[model samples]
Target: MLLLLLLPSALLLVPWAGAGRIIGGWEAQPHSRPYMAHLLIRNASHKFECGGFLIRPDAVLSAAHCVTGKKAVNTTVILGAHNLKKKEPSWQVFHVGHWVIHPNYSKDKKENDIMLLKLKPRAKLTKEVSYISLPRHNEQVKPNTTCKVAGWGWTSTTGDETSVLMEVDLKVLSEKVCENRFQKKYLHQSMICAGDEEGKKSTSRGDSGGPLVCNGKAHGVVSYGPKYCVFPKIFTRVSYFEPWIHEELRKFVLQDLPDSPSSD
Candidate 1:
């Protein structure tokens, strides 16, 4: 049986698998992934980072655990960034206007682990910054599907987090295989699994909240992995939350519209 451990907590004792990097991946081409968003979040005690991706002109999709239950006091989204350590001309920074975590998110079970951040001012779309398309309505990916997962973080379990963006190719595993590997009670239906079986390549301590892009569509949100990231990792299956995402986007648009004129 596999042990159940949160990536953040595991990172303290086991410096490798937590809410931050890519393991066994290579540097991504600058601005190649325009939808990518790097998050700098501060709580009362300290500051941390998480990965996210632009989903709309003013919205970003990420893991709920990245913000909620962490006492996140303030969060900033940086788009069009290639090397986080350098302030490039393409960077578009925005203060979070608001955020919405899934209503039924369960920290213990790690279910419904997704969230959306609304930018204070809508982002200006350009060649270097835009939104990634989501999975088609109710679409599902099959086993053995090759996908890409990208983020700014460690490229190895024992390595330092990288400043430049990195990405790796992963293969989706079947639901049955995932259940057999992870604790059944902790593994929810809404989550998907992906990674290399040999453990050669996987998401590590800083890759959380990043996307699993399958066939050019945003299909999953990086959730968690084992202490050493030795096998396939868990991701919040985006298709499961499509309806809720669309609904929230609709509400946001409605809120932005001017009030209707008074009746005569």
Candidate 2:
């Protein structure tokens, strides 16, 4: 039974993971989902540490748990690269400026697991790099509706990370099934549960913080799932936190950030 859980169980919601693309999925067209952002420690490990998207020219949205205990000065945001392993002309890397984690985020509780990254000098937008629109605060796609998830994470739970972007489509499971599978209060308005109940395809480890694109908008952030990515995947509902995101962006990220090349 696929269910939401308070414990992320090593999938996501634990600090420090790079959300790779989809497992049991197909490669994404080059530059598709251009808002995809890769986070890592510069000159550290060649592996990306998390996945994010450009909500603004200077701002990125990722999992708070992924960046916890790490300094913004030490992090790098890689944008416009479908393949991180190669040097692509469209790729641009930026250092982080503001490290804003949700004030109520609880590592122990594994709830409210989201954060914003301010790109130093902002990010340059090109044909290969663009933005994803956020789901309206009250918008929602019904259960069983198909949504797409993309990432550069592992193609399998134990497989090597894919060098290119991958994509998979998943159905939104009903809340009743989610309630039965997870603990009481595990499913909340701020969170969403969806996946293949048949154990065929889903995002696994190294795919945390990626976007769950539904109805051509970003409605969820890849949070976590079962060990093998079989169980239903959990996502932080973007609609529920619309105010929190806007408040922070309006107060901090909007001011004093440099313009992207396209914007200028």
Candidate 3:
């Protein structure tokens, strides 16, 4: 009777709750391909990892949440390598000089989810530690365009975390489809959507703040996803935030580039 009805409802709710945790936390399948570098944050006692890009010799751009609301500045940015669990002497470990989280960053809405880290010493640009080009201002990528996303986050809906960098091909979707899928939650002008319609390849939990690069240029930063970790990955559009990025870069130049002109 009533007990049977309630039991069925409880069973139905179990999967939803578990799905929420899997999609919301740092857990997923392992990816096969690697394309991005991740910055591992380790304090004296605790250790946490996040994704980032070597945008310059002296600066690494990542999500603000990755730096702020964390432990002391014993952070190390691992460059040129992906497998964190392995011991690779070739990978560089940089001491963090300073970090700047976007002033307008909102944890609830995830607005302005960008951050910049200054290394104690400048890293040399080579075949491995090269900088990725940022998108130009006013550049608008149309829907259905193919793009690539890479990170060291989880791979599948129920898989182990990845030690090596993982990359997947994604397709940009229309804002309308994104809004409908996510119910317009945190989907704004500064963000765009990408992924497969059938939940093929997409960003999952712990993939936040990674690069959604397209056309050899970084176009978005991983932001949010849907209930089942399916398609339609919401990404913060880099082009819309070009001005802020330039301003931040200028600040870095002023601090790091003593010989260069202040106007840079």
User: Best by TM-score, which number?
Assistant: 1
Write candidate 2's Cα lDDT for 166-211 as tens digits: 8899888878766655555355687788887776688776667888
Looking at model 2, residue 124 earns an lDDT score of 80
lDDT of 3 by residue, 173-201 (tens): 87777555555354557878777666556
Which regions of candidate 1 deviate over 4 angstroms? 1-16, 186-188, 260-264
Relative to the true structure, candidate 2 reaches a TM of 0.85
Q: For model 2, where is the 10-residue window of minimal lDDT?
A: 11-20
Cα lDDT of candidate 1 equals: 0.81
Candidate 2: segments with Cα more than 4 A from true spot: 1-21, 42-48, 70-73, 257-264
Q: What RMSD, rounded to one decimal, does every model reach?
A: 4.6, 4.6, 7.2
On a 0 to 100 scale, what is the lDDT of residue 151 in model 2? 78
Task: Write one digit per residue (lDDT tens) for candidate 1, span 170-256.
Answer: 999877656665655335458888888776778877668999999999999998766655576888889889999999888778767
lDDT of 1 at 44: 86
Candidate with maximal lDDT:
1
Task: Give the backbone clash total of model 2.
Answer: 12
For candidate 1, the TM-score is 0.89
